[model samples]
Target chain A: MSSAALVELRDVVVGYGELPILTGVDLRIDTGEIVSVIGGSGSGKSTLLRAMVGLLEPAAGAVCLFGQDLYATRPRSRGRLLSRVGVLFQSDALFSSMSVLDNVMFPGRKLTDLPDAVIQELALIELARLGVADLAERMPQEISGGQAKRVALARANVLAPELVFCDEPTSSLDPINAAVLGREFTRLRDDQGSTVILVTHDMEMVRTLSDRTVVLAAGGICAVGTPATLERSEDLDVQALFHGEPTRESQESKRA
Target chain B: MDVRLDAIRPRSLLHELEIHARTRPAVLRLDLSALRQIDSTGVATLRAVTRRLRRSGVAVELHGATPEVMRVLAETPEPDPPKHPPEPGVLESLGRSCFAWWSGLLTLADMVIEAMQGAAGAVVGRRTFAWRDVVEQLELMGADALPIAATMSFLLGLVLDFQTWVQMHYYGTESVVLEFVGIGMARGFAPFIVAILLASRTAPAIAAQLSTMEMRQENDVLRVMGISPVRHLVVPRLFAITLVTPALSLIATASGILGGLLVTVWLDPHWMAAFETMLREMTLGDLWLGTVKSVLFGWVIGLASAFTGLHSGYGALSIGIAATRAAVASILFVMIVDSIVTTLWTMAQ
Candidate 1:
């Protein structure tokens, strides 16, 4: 991984009204690395990601994306900064009014000067990679939840953004498509040097694909290291987390 | 609490178990050691018996299952509890409903008030409206609505005139029907009909669209991208609907008068005499009153629809419920405000 930071959180505090879920969260994400953020449900995984992605500004401290403070900058400059980032929200926020293919092509067309044909071709390839190519012509409402998640994932990566934030990209996916997503993220990093911030509970994906995993619990990051390193750590909570979430089969595979 | 299960008996075998379990044993154990044969019906009956007992706070245990019975039990999932939890008591339910209704009203009021602030902010800040969306909404709420409003108002006028003429013709005062039709259309019927038509047609559609977008979190994406969903979505439609409602009411008023004119031309042989009588009886205040009512109804429909939509719960079912609430609340509030306005105007006079 490159030493230059793509995103930095400095003593960040964020939460809903009148209560803080994450406090004094400090971390750095570098270029060309896939970082998986794993935590139990309601453990502030999505909240931390939201603060980093410019949706919820921190109550205190700083969130620096591409070396610029996301909230402290001018609105026009913030737009320019956000244009380089892509996000797949937990709800799979595909454009309900547009066909699936149009949704995948949206960011490329809006953020870049890419030709329409090129954008369409790129969108098709991304969709095929995620096993949602056939559903491209369908509207968001017509597809199943898994299909919508795949379509949303394809759209997020279509722009080959400098930074990508995906929340539970494989939660609704079957094993086959989820594996495809793992490979797609690898391709995104190897081919485009894109940095990915994956917030998910999919331990299998973390085991296979992440360069580093950030274990969030008790209001801040408890452990941050390679998955294998964290798996064998001395801390009881970290070992229990790695052991608890994955299946018995994954545990056997890890031993082997 | 070990209850022996020997064989599959027919009627009331499970019934006896259900009745026996009514004493609410802390634990009921079924020992299947002596069971030889069991069919699908027997398994289903046993499942239902276990389910009812469990629901009533009994702990059911199956033991001593032979290999065959074990295989049968493995294939079938343990009976699940009811999907919906039990309802609260009557008073509790009523209290819950009242609290929910009041809370929902408060939330809706906050959203609409914030939107009004945004609308005012846009004008003061000199921001440009999304003209394309505004034009499309204007076409939908005003121009496309024109024919329906005209036809409905015209038919209403025709019925009123014909009914009045039947009695007035005998008194040789048939022209007096024109006075009633003219004043009624300009002051009351035209505005009320147009308000109802737009409320039923456009308000629900707006709520559905906004709620769908909300469920999908599309606005959150826009917010993340440094754009306001209000600027991109809400203000444009509000601008158009607010501009169109009064204009459509004016057109509806003219169409209703024309319908009365058709009746006059068809009945008495002299068209000029009856037309002159209707014109002389009409006042500009009547037209202005209808316009004012249309303006009030327009804002009520727009704000109420937006309120339900922005506060809609997540998912398809909730979106549908919000749209229905939009139509009903808009119409109810329109009449309440109309009555208030009319009564105030009458008292002032």
Candidate 2:
């Protein structure tokens, strides 16, 4: 209910075609907060992030960004709205045809009217921040999956967006790369005061990086608490999910 | 239905417009049967200048809101809207398909037009063309094909002559062997037969190569690297076939005539006299026509085969299908094009 809420989704319902996926979801993200949404596949974590970014229209409810309704605006104005919210796709989605530097420059090229030299400089700075500046001129195909992920992150953050959405950013990366990206996400939120909404099921990431956590189950918010509190939830479903425990009836049946 | 009004820009008009717009939008409509007389100014303002509006907050249906509104909205030209096309119907769905049965038939007709244009382009592009691929294609398609062409031409001539001589010896017309072979090789037979062989053999081979490269995304890679696949791949084969086909035809002709000469020498006592007499009767125009046909056939086969390969889809099955179709279509097109050119040339004469 705070007026300072950077993004607020009120009773949102999202779906593809006629198949209802996420139903009546409500969430709020404030500036400089790193919020992680954790769930297994088919839980609609990614869909919620896309809906927040104005990429998908909610079937119901309002997606408000600083009190402005995102989907209600025209596409050009919506794109201008998107300039304030950077999104890293699950697949990285870097233009495989372009070099790493050019990939990093993509958002800036789309969002800003900066000159060529400034764009190049910003691209280099972003790549350097992500510690992959040396691979600037190499095509996406030439890089490892982890490097590609970081390059995508670098691209996402280059516009200095007020909010960043990362969907399964570390799914393909190694532990080392995941840890590096985790640090980068923290720095983005703490140092730069950019709100970060990471959509991932990586528990280690949720525990280590997230300032707050939202747990989705069957397309709805199952739990919203500090990661520790969610981890310690005494509710049967929460306890079973967190501990990977079988239900009592299933256990009894197996024993029989 | 209970509705909420957040805030209106002009508060004075709110009281009047609220009953009409509250349930829907700032720009709205109501069934006039449910209401008495309405204010025309309110209708005009709603129709004229509202930038944001929604009906029922669920869907965008401003179609029948107001005739004046619809007119004004129509006046607000949208060159390109965010188009989310509805799912297609049966015929529409098939029409959307690129490689459908009917589409394939259309593509066949299209290929003929493309082949003609391609042949013209190939001829023009051939002038300044320099590439290593031409030499490579020549080695693979032409030089390697020589032994087969030569062998077939020799055996065909030798068999025909031997058969004719046995029959002609009874009539003492065996001296005409020179005339028969000379006219056959020079006029049309040798070049036509050689071109068919090459079309069946080399055209498919070129198409298969280009198709594999296409399926593997190699052609796209080259394009992304600022290389024109047409220039890099097609033009080279164009030059190669143009040079090689004519040479192979000439070789086949010489080898065939030599085989005929050997038969004449073996059967007739005055073999030299027979040949010299035939030579005197034959003109260079006969040779020129055959050579021209070979060259044209070469260009056609090269271009058509390359076109098939380049246009192939991105699948393993598609590559094989494209290669096979290219071979068959190239031969068919070559024959058709040659027939048309020959008919036209004959008509002009």
The best candidate by DockQ is 1
What's candidate 2's DockQ score?
A: 0.02
Superposed by TM-score, candidate 2 places the C-alpha of residue B282 at a distance from the truth, in angstroms, of 2.3
- For A193-219, candidate 2 gives per-residue lDDT tens digits of 999988987877888888888888877
Fnat, model by model in order, equals 0.49, 0.00
Clashing pairs in 1: none
Chain B TM-score (each prediction, in order): 0.80, 0.63
Off by over 4 Å in 1: A1-33, A39-85, A99-163, A170-195, A201-209, A216-222, A234-256, B1-13, B19-31, B36-106, B117-129, B167-173
- Candidate with best lDDT: 1
Would you list the clashing residue pairs of candidate 2?
Answer: none
Q: Report the Cα lDDT for candidate 2.
A: 0.73
